[model samples]
Target: MNNLKGPVRVVGTGLIGASIGLALGRLGVTVHLVDADAESALMAERIGAGSRDVAGEPQVVVVAVPPDHVGAVIAAQLAATTSAIVTDTGSVKSKPLVDAGALTDDLSRYVGSHPMAGSERSGPLAGRADLFDGATWAITPHEGNRPEAVELIRELAETCGARTVELSVQDHDLAVARVSHLPHLMSALAAGTLVDAPASHLELSGQGVRDVTRIAGGDPRLWTQIVAANAPALTTLLERIRGDLDRMLIALGKDDGSGDITNLLMNGVTGAVRVPGKHGAPHTDDATVLVNIPDRPGQLAKLFADAAASGANVEDLRIDHSPGLAIGQVELAVKPASVDQLVKVLTERGWVVHR
Candidate 1:
């Protein structure tokens, strides 16, 4: 693993920021946590994110503040630091880069980065060292950017177990507007519709509804900042989706055997399958096994043990549990070739596997 020569400074000890600090600190590099909220910064330090004070000139500085505040924070950090290579973990980049350009004449030392990793949770207490593991981190270098500085930021990301991708700021924002931002908005909308739903309707909700609405539980304040910052791209994407939904509705209401609705639904299925998997590679033909696990201690451990003994690699997994359900569904993703083998192993071991 690559190491930094000097202490690394992390601004904003929220989930992403504190996570960067923790990951770097674990790699034997001294990390300095600088947040506008002193107590939060101190709490991050307490959780092993980094030290409390800026001891000296840091070699690299990561700005993990909210998207709206990223530009100002990056500018201030660049002005204050002696000569550190500065980067950010904000979700949107183009606007911040433009804002930074307006704030400072020296832009060579700064780079814009966004890690495609986060949970619905927020704050320093929610940070985990492995938050960036196997996730993509986009690095955007502008005209005045220093090659060394860009490489240093890449090294820092690699050390934190993130796969780095180079993209123009515009491309990054536009792409995420579809895959990330739009999804958050969709989930929030879907979840909001349930607010006035009848109690019986809510009780009937299955894993599918819950899965699609998970991001709705995120911090509203943070999301308000993100959605507002990336409004232009998100609005465009949403408009397209709106048009498609309108067409689908019209097609669904048609009495004649119009194939438009079927075609649209099929297109959505095809689009979803094209999404890359954990390693930045396309997922292969695979099957997911849903196991209803009892809500008790050691149930998850036993499930994993059976899976391991089955000689099948688990590509992905998700657990769905509600307040009153005695059982939670564990979705285990396995290669198509190994599905039968895993099913036999699981069934023979007496674990209830969903068909």
Candidate 2:
């Protein structure tokens, strides 16, 4: 990996920016934190992300501001820095490229990149050094960008511990619209239905609903800016979904015993299975085994130890807590071939195990 140049200035010390600082700090690179909000910058500095008082001009300036303000900041940073490569962490790339291009004739030093990793949490306090570890970072370099500058930005991403995928500005926008923005909108729409839901309905909530609604808990203000920035691409996706929804409604309205609804559901199953699993491998039909565990310390540890002892590598797991109960159900996903031995070991160990 090419070593990152000294004094990388990070603007807008929010979650993404601060995380970059922390990740770069792990590489022993000098990071200068800057934010419009003094408190945010100060908090980020206090957490050892970087110092706000770093001297000397920056070799690279990262604009991690909200989507709406990305272009103007990129333009400003490009104008302010003599030779520093300007890169952004914005989700949408085309808008910023256009926005920055409008303000300046040359975008040679400007590259757009997006880190495909984050929590629902925001702000500097929510930042961490390992945020980008093993995560995908998309780099969208416009035609006008210098090759060396683009390569430096790629090095910066690697230094932050993320793998890089290069795409065109328009291509990056379209890709994120399908993978990120569209899904966020779907999650929000599904979560919206539960706003006025009765307590009885909520009482029946389980891991499935929680999983679907998890990303919906993000800041709405941030999402509004993001979706609006990529309106063209996102609108295209939403229209396709609208067609499916109309078909679903038509199927529901008919009692003709047609298989339209079942086919639509089957389409979802097909797409779900095509989704990449851990380490970007093809999805697998891992067998899940549920174990009733006592709600006490060391119970989970013991379950894990027993599962390890069974010689079945636990692939994935989810814990579903029963309301007002002293027990939790752990759903463990393991290979089908290992399920029998896993179950036998757990059952022999006196665990309340079930398929």
Scored by lDDT, model 2 comes in at: 0.91
Model 1 C-alpha lDDT per residue in residues 65-113, reported as the tens digit of each score: 8888899888898999878999999889888887887898888899999
**TM-score for candidate 1:** 0.88
User: What TM-score fits each model?
Assistant: 0.88, 0.94
Task: List candidate 2 stretches off by more than 4 Å.
Answer: 323-325
What RMSD, rounded to one decimal, does every model reach?
A: 2.8, 1.9
**lDDT over C-alpha atoms for residue 323 of model 1:** 57
In angstroms, the error of model 2 at 69 is 1.0
Model 1: per-residue Cα lDDT at residue 322: 68
lDDT of model 2 at position 120:
75
Model 1 accuracy (lDDT, Cα)? 0.87
Every candidate's lDDT: 0.87, 0.91
